[model samples]
Target chain A: MQTGSLEHISDNNGPIIEVQDLVKKFGSFVANDHLNFTVSRGEIFGFLGANGAGKTTAMRILCGLSSPTSGNATIAGFNVYTQTEKIKRNIGYMSQKFSLYDDLTVWENFRFYGGIYGLKTEKIRERTEELLGRLGLQGEKNKILKEIPLGWKQKLAFSVAVIHQPKIVFLDEPTGGVDPITRRQFWEMIHETAKEGITVFVTTHYMDEAEYCDRVSIMVDGKIVALDTPLKLKETYRAASMEDVFLKLARAK
Target chain B: MLLPGSGSATLEGYDVVKDFRKIRDILGYMPGKFSLYQDLTVEENLRFFAGIFKTTPEANYDLVKEIYSQIEPFKTRRAGKLSGGMKQKLALSCALIHKPEVLILDEPTTGVDAVSRKEFWDMLDRLKRKGITILVSTPYMDEAMRCDRVALIQAGKIMDINTPEGIIKNFSSRLWSVRTNDTYELLLDLRRFKATRSAFLFGQHIHLTLVDNAGSEPEIRKFLEDCGHQSVEIEETRPTIEDCFMDLMKG
Candidate 1:
């Protein structure tokens, strides 16, 4: 619930993420090719591409999950290659497939993730109560995670991802298969989190969600074909919507 | 077999309770989750599914040829090893291999990328042309436009069923798109406005409806300016299917 207090690790004014000529190769196959981008503090950056278009590869490198073959990148002012431990400590990640334990209760899941992030016992308990209260799930805290609705599970996953108050959060298709109203509410939560000065790096299949980003970068065949604001990209491609722009770029042989 | 609930349903003119076995023979179902053997090769899985229907893949090869050919190169690979898009195609191919008259797909494009989602829908359009009654569900509102008719369901209840165009047409409220320098702040301010009935974020702009359509553009603009907001852009835009969905959900 608190905002803008976790700024001791990195300079507040510098770009939260920086990448230059990034490339990841696996046995002669290049998954990410010469990627270059910078994400400023508190900006919502949308990283988009088709499946197997190298978006995941680049995100892995930036999140310090995997080492890139060749590149210069820093996350939260720590080197991706040399300071991967520090980088991991300063960023949070949530994927659609795996973010929480299905068999555990809601409160237990929060306690477990908070423990993994090295939070104190008292702080974890306090934050858990606060989050459940905000989500209006105070009564459901004892319920198993699998029993909750899909929309509620996603919102809880997002809140848990930010429980550590990391400098940047990586969300991989956070709203997949969510209903219309819940999806918009999820974006509202994203805006609120970004307002608290946490940089959001998200990837989604929905093009309309791309319009919500401050800037979007489109990848195709392991290369960034376009990167700009949504309005500018639409105008440059002469497309009516982000969906059209994506089709034009992805299908342009 | 036990009837668990109160409602009675039928599939292809067969009562679901009395003729469940008969319905199963003519129904091709692909669940949202990939429900194939992960250790099995793609080809083996296809053959196994085909065998379940008392048929061989070769018997209905033409029906799945368009989709299967793309993943055929990886026929020997394990089903778990294929990428997201390829796994979807393989599941779809297996579902079609039974030559079922009715096909049901659940959230087939949930996590698929945009390009692959478009391609999958194109494949469905082709399948529809072949006279297969396909009943597919997707969370993406834009995809609703592709269907001849859509039933918006919320919390296990169907809200409305109509064509996408008809659904949009039924939104009788005058919707306005309002944008300003600060979108989040604008949302808060608009919600506080006296005549505003409903306000929600739609991409960069806030889609708003008036309280009984009483507020005009100038009135809303003056209210925003008075609240110390600038660079306001207001336009009366047509409601999208998503807009209608949000409206109906609220009602």
Candidate 2:
């Protein structure tokens, strides 16, 4: 397993994600308008926007799930347009609704996801044990996922997302409707994962979660209107919190 | 909807069991999930709900004027075609169309963007000023502070109930906000630090509570510096509702 400081990761200096003039249009409607940004190797990049501000469209394009109408982009040093398969192999994804199976046991879910990622059966077993041990869920490995608490299920889903040690992971509203304490725990896990050199690109409606990001980009009407550290963004907008900053930017459009 | 339960509750002096019909008439509920007929148009859904409550949309237009006016332009649009914020506004309008004396909203702001969430709460404030009693249940702890009183629930049990300020004031822990250059490393180190009682990351800093008889702030700072963390900053801070809830859950 690759476990070390971010510096130990190969290609530690260059940004893992790079996009230039990315645009995705749905017939007459422009979902992503000239989006351009770069995410560093191990940075926690928070992609925030209103419901129709084009976050999901851009994320889908980056995840190789869809094609952009016009743009240049790359993920993990592979061209998004030409090398989509390589991009898919290098990135992991977990959305709020479709990351795990409720009827599957803890071990089954891990094995299933690992298999999809092309891990060998023996390797899947080893990784499952290690992950379950780290999460203190060894006794519950055989338990069905539906019986687990929402918080633990979310954490386990995240663990399974990174089971193959992808270069980047995309989280779409991963903490929606979770209780307060569990939300913090899930973030701690995110930080731990980022510390292990996996770039985290997450989208969320929670503004406080925006503060946890190394940098945040707020999309307003399919445009990247603001991009900076939480403190810098707060100062730039002269706002007290990220929520206020978001309100000011989103309301402006 | 009846189940074997051991609880007694009332609304407007009507017992939940014996006067369910009366209680049902006077209560407006917007469940957490969007429950409006998806296949119905915006105006049709509103009219359908209004008809069920023995009212007409025109009869109570004043009550829902603020929210309904926002979506009235899209009246012919399907309920499923509206955006999240618009759907919520329509849902709130349907809930208030009957002019019920009491309104119960279940996590109305969940999954909503910050701007829409603020607008929804502002609309609630407007309703409250108009002589309506409002009860809202939300998982967002920050929303708890907006309420007059909040009940912290855990594992299907109510852990504590009080005004937001009162709950924070009663928090019996010496909380501190600790920051360092590497927050992730700082969290790992703090968890292993012998004097640490509890530590969890909150944005850029970790909300920490030291064990009783632990060393002072400077000593802890020194300890962290010795552990190779630079730019360490520690300051005494009061607990928010979330902090209080976590502490109560532990007890």
Candidate 3:
């Protein structure tokens, strides 16, 4: 019922991502249909769905990895179609599995990501040292990626993703099988990044994890059926918890 | 699929599929990926899924509206552009939005913030009151307490299934949580002790599994001190669900 359009919506600032009447089709399958939503700057948005729900397809469009069959979308004020290169430059991404080289050391991973972002060598070195020290990786800088524990690897992956300090960062499930303690530590890093005015977009299946997001969307069968804060969703569903609400919604479908 | 060789294999007290679905329905399930949309924004994502079960965001708009303010800030963000917590909320929103007869979550809190982790389980408590069958799988032993019933699962097998308290109650052995000046040295010394069966480190505390015939705590502490372990502290503690799980797996 809160159908406030993105342009007029005021909260974290202007809309960083605006999708209007978005549609995506693959042969006979409608991957996405009549999608519309807005993401404000510096907000941590949550994307959720069951498998084969077209979540990845929508992400590809926003990241400029694929074109939409219909509708309009803009990221960081640039069109996802016409200004894809610009969008790419302003946003960083980390896949669910991670986006780092196992063969490279922590410092090398930082340097590589910094280099790709076009940071100067001196700047890269300075930033790399700062990151390594902040993450308590100064001694582990030269350690092979494979040798580090999973929690440490997750931390390192986050460090590399933000090496260039992009305006927005997209993460797909960033935490899957890691221990609970490590996952908590990783989220601390995410909070730090968001504090710096960097928008975060992430997709995951953990309902409890959604309570931490600024807002969340539930996707089923290639469409988004609900979008709200965890508390709001709970209250609306008349369910005591997000999980129950999820089950209720999932079964209703 | 891997059943214990020692058990009498029978289903429904009869056929596997005949009773599996019926029994499974008494439990809820939330897979690592509940299978949602990736490309759609938070709003569309909810709507699409809502439509699938013959429901609309409009039908449940009031309930959705209650959580709306929390997600309003990021409502327009694409599903792909959200964070772990955000995605978790979305996925849960999809799962609970329809209200199932049973709720099942597979490692739902595996990767999330401490605050979010707490918040998520709190939601589950509310749902439990509604009398929905809840079956959840998690690797975290601490979360065991939150469930009405827990089934410690490993490698697709159920190690133990019982109420949280019941599981802990069944932890047959007495546990000692000890810390020493030379923890590693103490561990080595403890391992060789005739009364000790297992000695391993869990964070800062060294947990020792004692033999059935082990001596009293005071005597054990004295023995440890005599072995050159300084400032030894020992507590007779109840076994955790994890301990039971390990015991089950060992069997």
* lDDT string, candidate 2, A1-253, tens digits: 1111224334456789999999999999998999999998878889999988999889988998888999899999988788899899999898888658899999999989999999999999998988788788899999999999888999999999889999999999999898878888888888788878899999999898998888899999999999988888999999998999999999996
Residue-wise C-alpha lDDT for candidate 3, range A1-253, written one tens digit per residue: 0111122224555688899989999899899987888887767788877655778899989988888998999988889778889888888888766657889988788888899989998998898898788787899988889888777887788788878888889888887666444554566577567667788898875555565566788777678889986667888999776667666665565
Candidate 3, residue B115: the lDDT equals: 48
* Alpha-carbon RMSD of each model: 3.4, 2.7, 15.0
Provide the TM-score for each candidate, comma-separated. 0.94, 0.95, 0.54
Encode model 3's per-residue lDDT on B30-111: one tens digit a residue: 5686456778888998888677666787786654454445676888888887766678777777765565666767778775
Off by over 4 Å in 3: A1-13, B1-163, B166-251
For each of the candidates, give the backbone clash count. 0, 0, 79
The fnat scores of all predictions, in order, read: 0.71, 0.65, 0.06
* Error of model 1, residue A30, in angstroms: 1.1
- Please give the DockQ score of every candidate, comma-separated: 0.54, 0.55, 0.05
Q: What's the residue-level lDDT of B238 in candidate 2?
A: 81
For the candidates in turn, chain A alone yields TM-scores of 0.93, 0.94, 0.92
The better candidate by lDDT, 2 or 3, is 2
- The per-residue C-alpha lDDT of model 3 at residue B249 equals 59
Q: Give lDDT tens digits, candidate 1, residues A1-253.
A: 1111222223456789999999999899899989998888888889999998998889889988899898899998999999999998898888888658999999999999999999998999998988778788899999999899889999999989988889999999999888888988888888887887889999999898898888899999899999988888999999998999999998885
CAPRI grade, predicted model 2: medium
